[model samples]
Target: MMNFEMPQFALAAPEIWLGVMVCVVLVADLFDRSGEARFAFWLTQLSLLAGVWLAFYTHWGDSGQTTFNGMVVSDSLAALLKAASAALAALTLAYSRDYLRDRGLLKGEFYLLALIATLGMFVMASASSLLVLYIGLELLSLSLYAMVALDRDNRVGSEAAMKYFILGALASGMLLYGMSMIYGATGSLLIGEIMLAASGGENALLLAFGMTFALVGVAFKFGAAPFHMWVPDVYQGAPTAVTAFLGSAPKIAALALFLRLLAEGLGDLQAQWQVMAIILAVGSLAAGNLFALVQTNFKRMLAYSTVSHIGFLFLGLVAGSEEGYSAALFYAISYGIMAAGAFGMIILLSHKGFEAEQIEDLNGLNDRHSGYALVMLLLMFSMTGIPGTVGFYAKWLVLQALVEAGLVWLAVLAVLFAVIGAFYYLRVLKAVYFERVENPQPLVSSRGPRVVVAANGALILLLGLFPDTLIALCRAAFGL
Candidate 1:
């Protein structure tokens, strides 16, 4: 009989810990009647903290190993992303607690599903094979589908869930088909093996066809233009807390997916995929900015803004260099922080029965609470890529990558759309400070969310002031 080698389980400790904790939380919730929800909350937070420590441990000492027979890997990039995602998840739970408790949505199920989704992100970030990536993607998608409908009493929430489920299923099918085609062309399901096969220039036509479908699927997942039909509706319909979770951490996972599939697996096809990225990037910028100009709802506008941000993220990827890839990674991490803060502000301002959703809902925020209003201003500035904010540096780095790659024209077009996008973000600020509050209500008094939100805003400014550290870390992720 052939002997089997034992897998190196230590390399996968972070993911394994997360999986075990999620199960423990689920089982532990069963017997908790009076405090199930709150107990689940602290447990989830503790689990994430443990994950963060384990992720850092991997980054510092236990990397460069492909585990699970090449289905997953431990590397600096994956470790950093896992740590960041875990931190974001913990903060999201903190912001979500008051909102969920107030709305009778404080059930253990919400925390459980969110943790499951976080586990999916971890899987995607560490995936070394196409099959593993797709499994992670499905885990994430299905969890979010249920999350959108968490408020069963709200018909709009139900409608959004159905729409998301249907459209998400279609996207998943496209992605799987694309993966199959790539497997057919390259004769491998592993990304590293696919890269080797693709570099040989065999099955050219099949590779191109598979690449197209795969790019389409990536566009849909990123909510890029032409495939962004589901973003606005779901953001508008989902509870603000769920929206916050939906908007933030998964983005990092998506970026990891792109980097793995294109930059690593299909790097040899740069000439072919660059054009596709350009088209998607330009379309997303135009459609996202123009449409966001007319949106009155805060979350829907954010959804469109997300489209444009993804477009910017694509700029670096299109450049197809180590610096460009790292820049894209930096942008992804920065955007995740900005997005969580943006949606968290909505949760902070909302009350038991009142939703602070409408753009008008933020009118005269400064008059009601100047401190929170200032936080909103910083978040808006960062989202708009204003100077002295991390957003500005993020966009600037991507543009520099494009220019270095000799894509001057595309860079110019991106700047133009970015200017257009600035209008809506400025409009929100105007509502916060210049406009009048239609119905004044006290902001939430919970110190936890407030402190976290303030810290988030401060981070935008702090990172903007000193971006070298993050940029260096990102560069190191790619061994630059």
Candidate 2:
């Protein structure tokens, strides 16, 4: 007789809870006759809140615990990332609510899809096996694909969705193939076992090939250059609400994926992967900054900015140390907050029959509404990595990690590109404070979104002013 032990399902309490709520929200939305989708909206928010609570409650103290036969993990990192992802999702939904309603895109499906995507992120954060991570990635990717096309009436949106789908599928296939090769070489699907096999330096040639493909997949996911063709088009074409969601929470999940697959599983191959990371980092910084300079479209410019920020995030990975990983994690979380605020401002300025997609549309914003303009100013400053903002601290941490790792030239190069990136962000502030238009439209107002946007902007400054607490939390996630 063979003896078997039950998998400890409780370790994944947050994921399980979120999975249940995704179904509950789906069913609740079906019965909701309110054309405004009030029930579904609030229910989704409640679900997110519960998910955040569960993440911390279940895993706050855990250093690390693998369960589900080593397919899933509960740890400080997973707990923090999951909570942050869920909170960002809630904020994204909050910011999108009024904008979606005004544009007639407010529906139960949007809320449901967002929840499902959040659930996917949770799974990704906790996944310990390559197969489990791939499953989570697909769930997140497919939901995002659908969300991009939710505005079916928009041809540009449909085209963007198709492009995104094809490219995303291709990337997924490459990632799976890479994982298969790794499994074949290591004779195991588990990340720990892969690390053990890789550290032995047996089958070095095959392992290198598999790692190369895996790096490409990771680069594509991060919107790093050479594989970042989809970012600008999708960001510009999707509804502002969808773009806002895409810009924020999914980033935390991507960071989770990067840490798991590269920093954890492939740690033994650090020298090889670190060199590749440096190449991606430099390429992304140059391309993202240079391309962004000419973009008149606000969303497209931010998309390139995102690629550049990913470059900075990669600098930490290039360091290949635990402190570097924590620094990268901090950068990811900070960027997510700033990105949300940036997109939220776009949504705030837009109204029925008007889209605030162009940089010129922001002219005389201060004259029209000083308060909102101030918030926009803060976001722009932060994105520019100016001193006394979270963006600055985030960039500083990455550079510090680089210096510690003896990559002084790379650190200096990053600073140069960062200086180049500042121009476009300054142009945004110039429009807000200096430029005047013939007629400025009144800013739209929704109590919920307005308050959230205000808090979001304040957070950038607050975190900048006192970053140690969050920094410590990030370090703790790595048991440093």
Candidate 3:
């Protein structure tokens, strides 16, 4: 008789548990007779906490691990990104509850979709094969498509969902086609095997062509310009709560995708992919900043701001060094936190029948709520890369990595665009502090969101004041 043993599922405990809880939440929602949103909310919070706990428990003090026939991985980077995704998800739900309840859209579906999406993020973070990565991406993508249309009665929401679905499908095709080409050239489905196959430069032309298509797909998913048409519309139309979730958690997972695909699998073809990344980065910076300057809608403006930040994140990746990768990862985490806080503030100011999405909505906010205005200041300052904020450190690290890579001209261009970007950020500050109030309604928010937002802002400043630990953690992800 042949001896047989079961695969060790413990390596993916975080993902497994998250998936189980997602099903639990979905089923439990059906039996919820009380019809209270709080039940679902508390359950969602517990699930996210459990995810974080599992992620930390499995990877703490462990260099790295691979299991399930190398389809999954448990490493410092995966652990950190998974934990970040869970925390961001929990905070997003907290910031969303009041807004959704006010609009009568606070159903269990929102929390269920968010958690399922977060589970997909964990899968992407730990993916060790192209097939596994694509599966995770589709899971997250499909969840988001539905969430964008969650407010089924809103025409704008329906339109945004249609556009997102169509565009997302096209991008998925591009990614799939590119993966097919890479598989044909490398003759392997495993990333490690692909790395070894491509290292020999056996099919350089095929690899380059494949990388170009793959890069385009990555750019679209990252919301880089030229392919960033979906961002503004989606952000503007989706409920602010959904927008908050979309803008934050998925970014960490996207970064993981970039590292796993471009950095680890195609490291041998760096020169080819680097050029494509640079083009995407420069275009994103230029278009994101220039277009954001013309937007009156706050969510649209932040959408464009997201594009520019992705440019900075790309710079670190194009540099192709351990320091560069860590810097990019660090930037992704910082941006996620800031995005949550920025959108959370919008939700806080909004009340029943008011969206608070216009830049004018913030007019004279300082006169009414000085404390909230101060928090906004820190978030804006961080986005503008001003000193004494985590945003500054994030940009600084990317520039440092670029300079080290001898891309001084690119670094200079980035700084100049950053200057332009700062104008829009400062424009937001002017609305808060300098302009007079246009609406007489008071800013209403619940204690939960307020407390979370405060902590989010405090953490940004705290990380800015002392980012060594974060930097060290990021570096440790790469064993650098």
The numbered model that scores best in lDDT is 2
Superposed on all Cα atoms, the candidates' RMSDs to the truth, in angstroms, are 1.5, 1.0, 1.5
359, model 2: CA deviation in Å? 0.4
Give model 2 RMSD, 1 decimal: 1.0
Worst 10 residues of 1 by lDDT: 56-65
List lDDT for all candidates, in order. Answer: 0.88, 0.90, 0.90
Score residue 108 of candidate 2 by CA lDDT.
Answer: 92
Residues 195-300 of candidate 3 have per-residue lDDT tens digits of 9999988888888888888888888888988899999999899999999999999988889888898899999999888988999889999999999999999999
Q: Give, for candidate 3, the lowest lDDT window spanning 10 residues.
A: 437-446
| Local accuracy of candidate 2 as per-residue lDDT tens digits, 444-470 | 587888899899989999999999999
Deviation (Å) of 101 in candidate 2: 1.4
What TM-scores do the predictions have?
A: 0.97, 0.98, 0.97
- lDDT for 204 in candidate 2 is 86
TM-score of model 1 vs. true structure: 0.97
Evaluated against the true structure, the overall lDDT of model 3 is 0.90
Clashes of each: 0, 0, 0
Report the C-alpha lDDT of model 1 over 1-480, residue by residue, as the tens digit: 978778888888888998999999998888788753867888899999899899878754345679788888888888877887888877777799888888988889888888888888888888889999999888888899999999989999999999999998998888888889999999999999999999999999999889888888888888888898999999899999998888888888788778888888999999999999989888888989999999999999999999999899999899999889998889988998899999999998888899989999999999899999998999999999998999999999999999999999989999999999999999999999999856666665689888989998899899989999989888888887
